[model samples]
Target chain A: MKLAEAVAALSLEVEDPQILDREVEGGYCSDLLSDVMAKAAGGSIWVTNQVHANVVAVASLIDAAAVIIAGGMQPEEETVKKAQDVGIPLLSTSLSAFDVVGRLYELGLRGTLRDG
Target chain B: MPDVKDVGALMSVTYDVAARDFVRAGEAASKLKRLLQQLGLDPAVIRRAAIAAYEAEMNIVIHSYGGQIKVDITPESIEMICEDSGPGIPDIEKALQEGYSTATEEIREMGFGAGMGLPNIQRSADQFRIESTVGEGTCLQVTILHEAGE
Candidate 1:
């Protein structure tokens, strides 16, 4: 699904709108940056509670479609700037990580490597 | 004793990593990734190099007092050396085991200290070496070769 569509489906707050048009191939949920770096597939939407500039770096390195900061977390200002600079959408939602993952799964978003 | 002729012109840059500074932990790795991209290295090679650098950088930030990461990029390979003055690991073998972490609750909440740092870095590099002294510090050297035949 398109990132913009997924954002609307989940009621996520758009932190950066420039990236909403990118296509999302899958979803990955992890708080550990290293886990995402090693395992998350490119073009996947990364769902996590991590709110830091490093999250932006991980998203860029893995070529993630976007980042959804679950639990209504607010990232540092620098993180928002980094996301904008990299042109990756940074998003947030009031739902917990588990809930966000569940909703995305219901919306046909599977894990990057899982077979639906 | 390998032939030095295999090595090409080298470019090096160093970055200082401050301990417990979660805010700036991955800056070195991010910059290194950009440098590798600008050099037109293969995407897979750049990803591996960047992941290794980032994991090492996080280790220094979580476990050390402070340290520096030095990166040397060449046509043949990318090499990273991270050295930090901090509480060195007492048992390297145990520390290398996945899921064994000494990170505090604060660090855990920051999404790290799951004991995957060193292991992940090792997996990302072609050659990895780690040295530590109980009271002194720890040093890691990682090398990632560019795409084979490139």
Candidate 2:
């Protein structure tokens, strides 16, 4: 799925459109940056509630397709700016992490996500 | 000439462990990923290498006094070596248990060093080998097979 399509489907508000063209090949939802860094496949969408800047580092290191901050959470300016600079799309949604994962599953976009 | 097909490409990197520096820890793995990309490795193989490398790197920072990680990349497989000289595990058997963790609260705040680290490393690698001495250090070698189509 294209980044724009993922944003639209998840009802997420993207602060930048330039980074929205990247494709979403998979999805990984986790609050722990280590887990995400170690497990998130490249081009996968990362859904997390943590607003820490380290999240951006993890996304970059793993080459995540984009970042989806759930539960109406907003990241710091540095976080948003870094994402912009790195061409990593940053998104926010009012849905909980579980909710976003469920929706992504419904969209038939699941790929290698750990089962609960 | 090293047979590129049968002999894995040798790559080694040594990081100076600043003992309490968790902030800069995963940097080596990121660089390794970039190198792997430049080599035009398969995405699936790269992902496995990245996971094993990152996990091993994190363990060095969180558990070891200081150490280094070396990676051997091959068209057919990838091998990772992580060696650390910290407070060596007295009980290797128990330490390998899934829920066994010696990580402190500070490490937990950084979201790592979980008792699951070893298990996670094992799970991520297709083959895993670990060696440790009670008062010495620990050495871990992990291998992941690459599917030709991937």
Candidate 3:
């Protein structure tokens, strides 16, 4: 699935629409940056409740497709700026992480497993 | 053939890290990763190196008073010497254990302080060594080979 499609389907608030042409090959939901680094695969969309700038760092490091900050929590100014600068779409929605994940699953996005 | 006098360092850089500077916390690691990519290192190796380096950077940002991480990259390996001055770890053994962190509620709320930083670095490095002295400082020396057998 394309990140734009997912964003549209979920009505996600994109921090900037200039960088949503990525493919959503998989997804990983975690607030812990370490966990995300260890497991999230490249091209996977990261779902998290964290709005810290570190979220942007982890997402870009793993080459995540995009970051969907769940539960409507807007990210810090620096995070949004870094996301734009790094070309990772910083998105948010009123839905919780669980809710967003479920919606993404229904949209044909799958979670990435370590062994897979 | 004669011995090459200076073939050890392909590139080297040192980044200063400030304590509790969450706004710019990950920039050092990001710069290091970008350098590796520019060198055209294997993507997998770059990811591992970036992860370890980022975790180490975060440790200093969240825990230490201030520190510096020096990166050394060669043809075959990447070496990071991360050092922080003062308020060192009391128990290296306990600090290395997963699920044991001294972070405050604020740090935990930032999605770090999970007690997995060192272990995560260990998982990403080919060689990892950490030492610290109370009231002195902490020192971490990590090396990740370019051609990891992953």
Candidate 4:
């Protein structure tokens, strides 16, 4: 699925649409940066509760398809800027992390594993 | 395809990492990823190096005072050296263990300090080494080699 397609279908707030057409291959929900780095497969839609700029950094390093800040959390201005600067798709939702992941799964995005 | 010739000509690159600066933590690692991408390195190898480099960069940002990440790239391999100036790890044995971190509450709240950083880096690199002085600092060397088959 493409990020923009999912965002429009689910009504997710597109915080930054720098890479809306980017491919969304998988999904992973975790707030732990190391865990995300170690296990989240490339091009996954990373669902996290972190609202800091570092979230953008992690997403970029792992080449995530998009970052969904769940639980109604809004990232700081710097985070949105960083995401835009790096051409990463940043999204937001009022749903909890679990709910967000479930909806993404419903949209046919499965979680892929990367061996740590 | 990008100029593989440029990647072959590459020797070493380095970047400064600021301590406790979560905002800019993954800058060096991301740049390294771009360089590898430009070289058209193996996707699997590039991902491994990127993840490892990110974890190493985060360690210096979360634990040490400040540091530098130096990377050397070739068609066959990538070597990264992360050296930091801070209160070094008192026990390498314990620090290498998963789920054993000394990060403050603030860091934990930001979704770090999981004690998985070092372990993750070790897992991603084909060869990993660590050296630290109690009061001086810590240094990590990580190398990821690419296979011909990809």
Poorest 10 consecutive residues by lDDT, candidate 3 chain A: A107-116
TM-score between predicted and true chain B, model 3: 0.93
lDDT tens string, model 3, B49-81?
A: 888889999999999999998887888798999
Candidate order by lDDT, decreasing, is 3, 4, 1, 2
Best by TM-score: 3
User: What is the C-alpha lDDT profile of model 1 across A20-109, one tens digit per residue?
Assistant: 889999999999877888888789999999998888888987889999999978888988988998888999988999999999999999
- Candidate 3 TM-score, true structure as reference: 0.94
Which candidate ranks first by lDDT, i.e. highest? 3
Q: B1-150 in candidate 1: lDDT tens per residue?
A: 111232348887888888888766777888888877887888878878877888888999888999998888786788888999998989999998988999999888877888888888888778889999998999999988886421
Off by over 4 Å in 3: A114-116, B1-9
Candidate 4, superposed: residue stretches over 4 Å from native: B1-10, B148-150
Best-first order by DockQ: 4, 3, 1, 2
Model 2: runs farther than 4 Å from truth? Answer: A8-16, A33-41, A76-86, A102-116, B1-11, B15-17, B74-77, B134-136, B145-150
For candidate 4, give the lDDT of residue B149: 29
Ranking by TM-score: 3, 4, 1, 2
Candidate 4, residues A1-116, lDDT tens digits: the string is 98888898778999755569888889999999888888888899999999999898888888899999999999899999999999888899999999898888999999977754
Cα lDDT listed for each candidate: 0.85, 0.74, 0.88, 0.87
- Give per-residue CA lDDT, model 4, range B1-150, as digits (tens): 211333445557887889888778788888888888987888889888888888888889889899998888865678888999999999999999999999999999999999998888888888899999999999999988887322
- Prediction RMSDs, each to the true structure: 4.6, 4.8, 4.1, 3.2
Candidates, DockQ = 0.52, 0.29, 0.63, 0.69
Stronger candidate by lDDT (1 vs 4) = 4
Fraction of the real A/B interface contacts present in each candidate? 0.68, 0.25, 0.68, 0.89
Error of 2 at A109 (Å): 4.5
